[model samples]
Target chain A: MIKRLTYGLVALLLLAAGPLSHAQETHTLRLAQTWGPNTPILAETVQHMADMAETMSDGRLQIRIDPANKHKAPFGIFDLVRNGQYDMGHTASYYYKGSIPNAMFFTTVPFGMIAPEQYAWFYHGEGMELMRKVYEPFGLLSFPGGNTGNQMGGWFRKEINAVEDLDGLKMRIPGFAGEVMAELGVAVTNIPPGELYTSLERGTIDAVEWVGPALDFNMGFHQIANYYYSGWQEPGAEVQFLISQKSWEKLPPDLQEILRVAMRTAAYDMYIQSTHSSGEAWSRMKDDYPDVTHRTFPAEVIEALRAATDKRLKEVAEGDPLAQEIISSQRNYLKQVRQWTNISDKAYLDSVAGE
Target chain B: MIKRLTYGLVALLLLAAGPLSHAQETHTLRLAQTWGPNTPILAETVQHMADMAETMSDGRLQIRIDPANKHKAPFGIFDLVRNGQYDMGHTASYYYKGSIPNAMFFTTVPFGMIAPEQYAWFYHGEGMELMRKVYEPFGLLSFPGGNTGNQMGGWFRKEINAVEDLDGLKMRIPGFAGEVMAELGVAVTNIPPGELYTSLERGTIDAVEWVGPALDFNMGFHQIANYYYSGWQEPGAEVQFLISQKSWEKLPPDLQEILRVAMRTAAYDMYIQSTHSSGEAWSRMKDDYPDVTHRTFPAEVIEALRAATDKRLKEVAEGDPLAQEIISSQRNYLKQVRQWTNISDKAYLDSVAGE
Candidate 1:
C-alpha cells in the first residue's frame, strides 16, 4: 500500500514539473530566401538574423534557411510564405507587383527617399500601418529585411548627355524602371545574371544596371563601360522578410520580440555593410579601371526620366484605392522629410565638396 | 524501509533538476546614462535597449537604468562603469577626452565621416579594434550607443558671408568645435542651457550651436536667430555604451548576445528616430517662425574653417602615435569612402533636387 501511495506522489510531482520543462521546448522555423546560397550582403543578413534569434532565445528558437537553389523558386517566396509552405521568406516586395499590385511601394520608388528617410517613414510615419494593411489580408506580416543603399544607374558604354541618347538604347534593366526606360525609347532587355557580362562585353547591350559598386564590381562591367551613372530608379531599395501569421501566433511573446528585434538589427546592419563594401569596391574599381567614369544623368535626361516615372506612378494609382493610399502616404512623407535632408546632409556635403 | 528508499530517490531527482532550473536564473544589470530623465532620443535609446534585452532574454536579463539626475554624474559615466560602480553606462566618448584623449576619436571629429561612413569604419574597418585597445586598459567594453546624424552648425543672428565674418563672433559652441572656432577668432563661450536663449537674444552670443532641429527646436533658438546653418563640425556624433569587463564576463553566452544585439538595434533605431523627429521639428520650426532661413557658410568660410580644423588635428596627432594612427586612418578612409558617397547619394540627391 505504501509503494502505491509513493508512486501516486511521483506521478503528481512529474505533472507539476511538466509545464516548467515545456517552457524550454525548442521551436524551429523554416525560412526561404530569394538569394542564392552564399550571396554576400543579402544572404549574410538572413544568417545574422537567425543567429541572433537563436542565441537570444537560448536554443529554444531555431531558424532553418533555404536559399533559392534549395527552394527552386527565387521570385515565388511571397506565395510560399503566404500559403504556409514556408514559415518565413526573405525577398523584395516589388518582385511580386504582378501578383499583388500594392506590394511594390514597400520596396522603393523612383526619386524616393534614401535609406534613413525610408526607415524613418516605416517606423515613425504611416509606412508600417500601410504595409500592414497590404499584407494582413494574406495572413502575412512583413518587415524590412535589408537595404542596398543608393543603387547605381548602370554601366554605359557611351555618355548619355541628352534625352535622345536613350533612343533605341539596348539596356539590361528590370522591373518598373525598365517600363520607365521603355517610355524613353530604350529597348529594355532582361538577361540572365550569368550572361550579363558577355551581353555588355559584346554589342548586345549598351548598358547594364546591376546594384551599386559592391555588387557591380563582380560583374566586370567597369572594364567594358566608361560611364558609370548614378542611380535614379531605386534610391534606397529595401528587401523584406515576410512571416506567416500562423507561425507568428504560435511563438511565445518573448520569442516573437526576439525575432522582431533580430530582423530589425539585421536590416540596419546590411545597410552599413553595403556602405562599407561599396566604398572598398569602388576604390578598387577606380584603381584597376581608371577609365571608368562616374556620371549623373544630365538635367534634360533626369527631367524626362522623372516625367516618365510620374506617369507610370499615376497609372499605378488609377484604380486601386489601397495602392493610392500607400503611394500618397509615401509621396507626402517624402516631401516633408526631403526638405530636412536637403538642409542637413545635402547642405553639409555641398559645403565640404571642395575638400 | 520503503519510505526511506523513496525519499532518497526524490532527493536525487531534485538534485538533477537543480542545474536545469539554475539555467533559467535571472540577472539584472544597472546602467547609468549621461542624459537626464525623459530626455528625448538619447534617454529613449537607453530604455529601448533595455526593453529589447529583457524581452529577448525572456525576463532572464533585466537592465535598470539611472539617468543623470539619479546618478548625479552627467560626465562621470565612464568612470562609474570603469570602476564597477555601475555595470554599464550610456554616454558620448568625447565627454571623457580630458581623462582619455583617444576617446574623443571614437565619438566624432571635425571634417570626419558622416553617420553611414562612420558606422562602416567601426564595423568593417579598424575602428572596433582601436576602440577596444583604448578601453581595454580600463577594463571596459564600448559599443556605439546612438547617433545624432549630421548636427546643424548653429543658429546665427547674422549671416556669415566671408571668412572674415567669423572674426570676433561671439558663439556658444562647445567641445572641439569650440576650439576650432576660437582659432578662427570667434569669441567662444559656454553658457548654461537655460541661459542660452536669453544670451543669444541679448547679443551676449552672436550664435548658438546645439544639436540638429530635433533637440535644438526645443531651445527656442529659432525665435531669436535667423540663420540656421548646416553643420561642419561633429558631422556624425555617435554616443557610446560602456560595460564593465567583470559584468560582461558574468553573463551567459545567450544573455551576452542579447545585450549586444539590443544595444546595436537601439543605436540604429535612435538614428531613424532622430531623422523622423528632425523632419517634424524642422517643419514646425519653419511654420512657427517663417523668417528663419537655412544657409551654408560661404565657400571661403568653409575653406578657412577646414584649414583651422586640419591644423588642430595635426597638432593633436603630433604627440601621440595611436592618435596619429587613428587620425590618419580616418583621413585615408574618408578620402576613399567620400568618393563613393559623392558619386552615389550626393549625385542622386542633386539630380532629383528639382523634383
Candidate 2:
C-alpha cells in the first residue's frame, strides 16, 4: 500500500511539472499556508474565491491553496510573500505588532471588538483602511483572516480567586492579555513550548492562557497544571492574512477579488469552529480532571479586569492618534456585536452549561 | 509617514471592496501551524501558502493561517490537521514517532543528512513519495519544507571536553537528538520552555540545544551557559507541511497546479532563511557577551558521535522496512546532488570549517 501511494505521489509530482510556468503566464497562482486546516475563520470561503475568480475571468485566472505548511512558517510568510519568497501569506496581524504596533488593532485586542463587531469595524468603520496603512510600510497588504466569537477566560492554576493571585504570578500570555495582566498584577511571561513544561513543573510559572481545549489537550498541559481557565482574556481574537505589496500589485484585479471572498469564508468558519469544539474539549477536561477545579473569576474580579483592560487600552492608544482612532472604532463595533451574541452565543452557552 | 501608510492601506481596502463577494459566493480556507512568525520554519511557510491561494484564485480562494496557539498548541497541530480540524498544518514528521515510526524518516535524524543532501533526497529521490505514504493513513497530504541546517551540538555549561563529561549529564532535547543523547549516557529531559531556564540555572541540566543563536539570544541562554557548540547531532532538521485529504480534494485542478509549484518555491527559499540569519545573530551575541566561549567537540568525541548517528540510521532502517526504503532512495538521490554541491557548498564549508 505504501509503495502504491508513493508511486501515485510521484505521478502527481511529474504531472505537476508541466503546468508550472504556464500557469504563471495565465496568472494562475497557488498559496500555501503552513498551519492547521481549521484555524482560519472561513477557509472554505477562501476556497470559493478561487472558483469565483476562475469563473469570473472565464478560466483566465486561477487561485488554489496548499493548506499545509508545505512551504513556510506562519510568521516568515509575510516576508516571503513580500520578497516574492511566495506570492502571499496568511498570518495574525497582531504577531507583527513588534514591527507595526497599529496592526494589532486589525486582528483583535485584549479588550476589543468581537467577531461581528470586528467585522463591522473593518468593513464600515475605518479599521480596514487604517490596517492597510500599517501594512504599506512593510511592503505588505492585508485582510482579516480568522476570528473566534468570544473566547474563554483562559486556563488557570490554583484559582484566580482574587486579583491578588495575579501578583507575581507568572502566567503564559500574549498580546493584550500580557498587557492587561500587568495591570492586574501578573508577571506576564512569554514562554513558548520546548520550555513550558520544565517551568511549570519546576515552579517557574503559575499559569498560562492558551486557546480552548480542542488545542489544550494535545499540549499535555493538563499533566502539569491542576487548573485550566477560560479564554475570557481574549474575548474575540482574530487572525489575519498578510499579503506582500509587490505580489498583491502584480495580481490582476479579478484575482484580488477571489482572495477577499476567501478570507471572509475563513472568518465565518473559524467562529463556528471555536464555538463547537472548544465546548467539547472543555467537557472532556471536566470529566478527566475531577480534582482539577474549573471556576469562573468572581464578578468582582471580572469587573476589575474590565476596568484594567480599559486602562491599558487607553495607554496603548495614547501612543498615537491612529491607535486612538482604532480604539474608538473598535468600541463602537463591539457594542453592536455583543448585542447579537447575547442571544446567539450566550443563550446557547447558558443552555449547555446548565445541562 | 506612518499616517500615510495607513492612508494607502485604506485605499487598498477600498479597491478590495470593488470585487467584494456581495453574499453571492465566497471561499475561505484554514491554514494552521505549530508556531509563530518567529519560528523560521513553520511560521514563514504558512504565510506564503495563504498568499498563494489568495492571488491564484483571485478573491475566490482565501487562506487564513492560525498562528502558534491561536487555536491550538504546537504538538496538537498534527492531530488537528489529521482529524480535519485544520485544513493544513506545518508538521515535524519525526516528532510523531510515538504514533508513526516511519514518519521519522522524513525529518531529521540524530546524525542524518545535512540540509543540502537532505533536500536533494526528498526532492530528487523517492523520499517525498514515501513520506506521503506514511501520512496517508491519517488522511494527510504533505509538501517538503526547509531544513534547519546543521544545528549546534548544544549550549553547554560544562564542555563535553571528553566522553566522561557526557556521563550523568541531564540534557534538554527533542526528537532524534534525545535518542542519540540517551545512547550517549546522558539523562535526557524533555522539558518545555517554562522550565528550561530554572533547570539550567539550578544545574539540573548541564546542556541543551534549544536552537541557534537568534532564538537562544532572546532566551538568554548566554547568562546561564558559557559554551556554544557546533552543528552535528542534527546536521539538517526538516519541517513539513500537512493538509487534510478532504481539503486537498476540494481544490480545482488548476489551483492544485498552483499549489505544487508554490510549494517548490517555498521549500527552495527556506534553505537560506533557516541558516543565514543565525550568522548575523551570533555576531550580535558576541557584542553582548564578549566573554562567551565557542568550541567544537574533540576529534575522538566527534568520531564516536558520528558512529552513534550512523548506528541510529541503521537501526531505523533495520527496525522498519519502510524506513529502509526511504533511506535507500534518499541516499541515492543525495549522491547525485552531492556532485553539484561538491564544487560549491561542500568545498566551501570543508575549507572554512577545517581552518
TM-score of chain A of each: 0.98, 0.77
lDDT of each: 0.92, 0.63
Q: Docking quality tier of candidate 2?
A: incorrect
Query: Can you tell me which runs of candidate 1 are displaced by over 4 Å?
Result: A8-12, B1-4
Q: Model 2: share of native contacts present?
A: 0.02
| Model 2 residue B258 lDDT score | 50
True contacts kept of 1: 0.72
* Per-residue C-alpha lDDT of model 1 across residues A73-170, encoded as one tens digit per residue: 99999999988899999999999999899899999899898999999999999999999999999999999999999999999999998999999999
Stretches of candidate 2 exceeding 4 Å from the true structure: A1-355, B1-25, B36-41, B349-355
**Tens-digit lDDT track for model 2 on B1-355?**
5456556545554444433323113457687777875665457766765666556555556777787768756767778888878888876777788788888777765544555456545644466788888888888887776555556667899877787788888898777777776777889988878788888989988888886664576778887788877656655677787878898788766455555544544554454444434544565676778876777677666666667766887876786777887777765554444332332222222222211
Model 2 has an lDDT value of: 0.63
Task: For residues B123-163, write the lDDT of model 1, one tens digit per residue.
Answer: 98988999998999999999999999999999999999987
